[model samples]
Target chain A: MLEVKNLTVSFGSHTVVNNVSFSLGEKQWLMIVGPNGAGKSTIVNAISQGVPYRGSVYFSGKDLAGLKPSELARKVGVLSQRRFVSYSFTVEEVVRLGRYAYSSSIFSGRSDDDEAKIEEALEVTGMKPFRGKSVLTLSGGELQRTFLAQVFAQDPRLLILDEPMNHLDLVYQKQMLELIRRWVGENGRAVISVMHDLNHAWAYGTDALLLDKGRVVAWGKTADVLTNENLQSVYSMDVYDWMRSLLSRWSR
Target chain B: MSKRPEGFKPVAYILFAAAMMTVMVLCICAGSVNIPVKDTFTAIWNTVFDLPMPEDIPWSIIILVRLPRVLCVALAGGALSLCGGAMQGLLRNPLADGYTLGVSSGAALGAVIAIAFGIYVPGFALAGTMAMAMLFAFLSLVFILSITYRLDCSLSTNTIILMGVIFTMFANSIMSLIVVFAGERIRSIMFWTMGSFAGSNYVNAIVVFAALLVFGTAILLYSRELNAFAIGEDNARHVGVNVRKVKLVVLISVSALISVCVSISGTVGFVGLVIPHMVRMLAGPNHKRLLPASLFSGAVFLMLADLLGRTMLKPLEIPIGVVTSFIGSVVFVYIFYSSRKAK
Candidate 1:
């Protein structure tokens, strides 16, 4: 299980993520939804140790206060919304970097298991065909999948993806969400995703955390926290009645 | 796809670099004087083994003067190019070079000031100037970097470039003022500005060669970290890199290399700017291969430039700085046009 207690992250004098507390059980999927500047990304960044925050994050019964980046990477894999590569690394070479945390030593020869994991990640992400191609020349959807393959290759206990569906098409969006859901369900690992699409979050997430202006407005089971009134208030849209009718139809 | 194993590629690159270094050393030895290959080996053997010098052997001509100067040129060339390549990776800017951050101008101003004031015992003036240049090069780097850090803005690529230009202009004005006031030293200052490898001896050559070896190996050891840094500090940190530590290492190593090169060659230009980009064009930007390749190729390139400078005008040796600029500008123009055509 992963737990965050009173997580408060500030920039200068302004608090971007204030007093946010939550936990995720094994095999659970928690989706965070908020409008722009609602501090959703900041919260994920804090939990992933990408930014400074004033609180305690406990993972697997250990405080992550002074842990180094490599140690944190061993247990938590993070995929930020922006992905940039300055060189023309081949897809296979790029995927191999994910195994850096698992390697016994910097100079040690790669084991067969490492190669196997890489191959499996590529296969699962449907990137097997582009393994030898340079990632620099890939299309947007292909590049996103390549990064997903890298995350899968990492094989961390906890996966945190910030807007993983940004550049993906409809088919890739379905493929990626199904893949993450299956991974969590089968492996009993925790997955937290920050998403903007309310319908997709409701469809795929087992739990939901809603935020407004850096504070958690609601948290719990997806169905309960995603009520029409909460959606209308958080999103500031009058689509609650239409969303309720659609939810009822989907339930049937 | 077949796997070549994880660490094999970097080893191959190292071996290639060694081979290139050997070829460059031989080329440096075989110069306008046209010493036979056998005689060159004999001279090297006698010097290393401390054997009795043959009555006919030319010790002063071969070992004492030409060899040390040649080695110094090679060392400065390799160090400047390698540091330039690493700086480009660290700053994530293709235009970054050894001289880009005002280091060359700072060194030049320091040397000129030392010269104008005659800040040494009569015979030790050049040595004092070199020491002063090294000191000023490091100080200038620290000053610029601290100011940039204190500004509390993201160190964007354009901002770094702008700061570098501003600092360069400041250093240039100081150097110009010194040159104008000390009119009698203009000839010496002009010679120093147009770099020459005239008086390099074994003592200074050893110092330069050792510094280059240490700095080059240090940069190569951090090749993976440099590759991570090229993507940006935030991305590097996200990927589990200690960004601050890596940046410090790169900055210190590059600064040391530049200082040493300035001490020896008096601000030879364009090798740092052109060679690394040419290497990247050929080998891609992976520092694992790029660093070592730039080192060897840079040595060869500068040695050839030195040979041309010496041989082009037989009795009157041209300054190496002019030769390198002429050759480098031609190559750069060709590369620019070809890349544009490709686009």
Candidate 2:
């Protein structure tokens, strides 16, 4: 459903993502994992057309760069590392903003019950109770859920999320991943997410791409790519033993 | 979630519009020339329907003098407030306005130069004044941005405001020089700088209203895009808002309207600075409501301010800028205290 060909991104003389190429078919959930400044967000930013890049990112056979912002947005929904809402807008209003590509003009208002897609999104994200709450007063976890509901409402075929659950609580993180799993279970839908938690990636990702220093260290089925050798080399630490030790701390 | 949040509220619209019209009509009866409210209404009705005027003294007052001044005041108020509302949305900072961005000073500089040299566009002095003011306003934004960029690549809020202040000081110094050299026009320059609606007429009123209608509607149309910025510009872009295009259209339109306002009533302080923040507090920060509320509320606020300035001393009128700054500062203090307390 999406393709990145020799994607290279840089800042002045500093190269952040170098000659990284990967592709995903429909129903695939590709998890990008790396340490700090591993260019996970940069790669996602490049795919979402938020940054200029040397290589092309094709979405459903169309080059994303050639599309208008609204056109690109129709096919791609991105949940960024969220920022705080300082104003007094309700969560519903913020979520409704995701439908900008579908709205007729900037002046158009939210549609009625007949077009209740947004309401459905709010429901799935478990933000139904807080839909009317002012986003400014929301806690970090609630705010993240509100934005997650927003991306859900955008109803794009491909979801690109950069550390989407960073602000979410543990239970909500599981719920968010479940929602994504359900979403990608459908036809013609896929996801590319940058995650910090290897456990979540191993558990949730069907396809995983491990990146180190902006280059792809391993890429294949999640089970194949997240081997002890691959994880140890990229992280410079023992992977399975560390998980076992952490589990032992709470063991009976 | 079965019940959607409120969308557009016609009640608020009707209420604001009615209040604006009512205040504007009542303010027509101000000034020492005591025209009765009945006469004011009759003259206004006659003029609206294009009937032949009654040819009385009150008819001339309503048709010729009071009407234009009132319109100019209302337009300036709406223009400045809308400019502030849009700037606050684009910058996602409540403090962003023409005054803080040095755009108002740039506009005042333009108006001052035109008045100093007696520059007029043949028969239309208003055009020359507005043209020069708009030019300087745009240039001032560009200059402030360029200088700020040179100093700080990130263009942080601190750097931008600092540049604005530096530019404002430099522009004011030059304006002072112009005021100093004016031998005969010193009185007019002083009045212009102080911000007043004295001797206004139909030409100034109609031209400014037309400009406001165009630019003001532009801002209103872009309100949704502005709403997207509430999260932050980067996220706004992620949601398909062409942030750059929205910013350019809004800022240019705002500067143009503000230039027209300054050309009419010389940098009336705090209408822009205070009105949007006040309206946002009352109406909530959805730009859809906030921008339009700023429009009507600003009109009423300025009308009351100008009227008070005109009548408070009877014979000795206070400057409109002085009245607003005095009142606005008090109201702003209360807002700060209340917001802090709420926090």
Candidate 3:
């Protein structure tokens, strides 16, 4: 379980995220939806304690700020925006990085359990075949999936993913969402994802938090918060009118 | 494509260790006065085991003259290469080494000043040059860290490398000024800058060994953290590495280790820069394999280079620095070309 209270992030005089608050429980999936520059990713960063902010974030009833990074990492996994790496590493090796928190010492090799988890994560992401391949040679979508496998191997109780679907194809998109859903459904873990796709959020999210200009616009069930009026106001699009026009065009 | 299999690492390490042992024996045997390999082995075994000394062997030449120099060469090489591997991982730059970062220049400046001013510490067991070199090496490390910190972009290789370049320029200018006024001490200063193990004794070799054990073991403990850092600082943090603490500890300890190395054997070039890259090329980028591999390869490479320097012209000993730098530049160019081709 995770809780955020009046989280605010600012740079100099410009506030990126305002006093917004929300609570997420185990087995719940919260999708943050907003337009560009709407503080959506900032909220994820704030809650994950990756960036400096005012207010408090609690994980399992303890203040997130008080926990050491290695300690917090055991409970929460984070996947930020995609970035490039300078060195060449095998896909299996990159995924093994996720087990860093579990590794007892540098002198010891990975335990049998860690290897099993790595294999399972690779299998879950359909990356088992590429275990011996270099990450430098992977395509964007493949690299994205490789990192996803890494986060999965972390096996954290709370997963905070910022734009996890950025480079994924439609098939992988489906697979990823299904895997995340199962993580919550079967394992009772929690997931908070920042998403740009309203349709995906509506179909997959149990709860939705809409943010615009650093303020929370709405927070509730996905269906309740994704009404035509709310979509029109927040996204500046007449959803119903546009849908009708698109439907007419398709009929023609 | 994937690299050579991970199994290649242990094999490579064993080969390198064997090469290091062979080079050590050859270095002890092939000095100005040639002692047969058999005599060299007997002298070394008898001295190490403290058995009755061999009456027919040149015990003084083998033990006092050559063995200490060989040990110093190997230790300095290992220390430099380990520092290089750590810095490259820390800076996320494959080319990073003490010379590039001006840390070695700082130590050289300290040594030159000590020699020029005749500043000697009576109580210290090691040479005054070693003590002053350690002092100035620490100072240079502190200075570099301060500038990088003040720039507030420690993660950016461009900023760090640029600051290093500027620091090197500043230090070199001071060194030039010292050379201009150094008059009678110019030869000594030049020899020190060019690096050598000619005057090394068993005591200093032990000191270098102790430094390698302490600092090298500590760096090995941080191999996991270094692997994470090589990816990116933020990525390292995500993987539960305390990035700041790891960087600080590695930088300080490595600088101290290099300073101790420079103190005993002067500032050997390319052993740090080239050996790590060679190890990585052979064993891949994982620090667990790369660290120890670099250590063995470095020791072997430097001992060979030192042997070449001594025997190339016979009695006209070339500075070890010159040989390594020459080889290092060729390797640097080759790496640059290959990396570009990779792109």
DockQ for each candidate? Answer: 0.41, 0.59, 0.50
User: Distance from true position, residue B136, model 3, in Å?
Assistant: 4.5
The pairs that clash in candidate 2 are: none
Q: Which candidate is the best by DockQ?
A: 2
**Candidate 3 on B91-132: residue-level lDDT in tens?**
777778887677887887787778778777787735687778
lDDT of 1: 0.77
RMSD of each: 4.0, 2.9, 3.6
- TM-score to native of every candidate shown: 0.87, 0.91, 0.89
> Least accurate stretch of 10 residues (summed lDDT) in model 2 chain B?
B1-10
| Each candidate structure's count of clashing pairs | 0, 0, 0
User: Between candidates 2 and 3, which one is better according to TM-score?
Assistant: 2
Q: Which lDDT tens digits does candidate 3 get at residues A64-128? A: 89888788778888877666766777888888888898876665665778888888999988899
Could you give the candidate ranking by lDDT, starting with the highest? Answer: 2, 3, 1
Give candidate 1 regions above 4 Å deviation. A241-252, B1-3, B6-33, B52-58, B107-159, B179-194, B327-343
TM-score of chain A of 1: 0.94
Query: How good is model 3 by TM-score?
Result: 0.89
**Number of the top-ranking candidate, with TM-score as the measure:** 2
Give the distance in Å from residue A188's predicted Cα in candidate 2 to where it truly belongs: 1.4
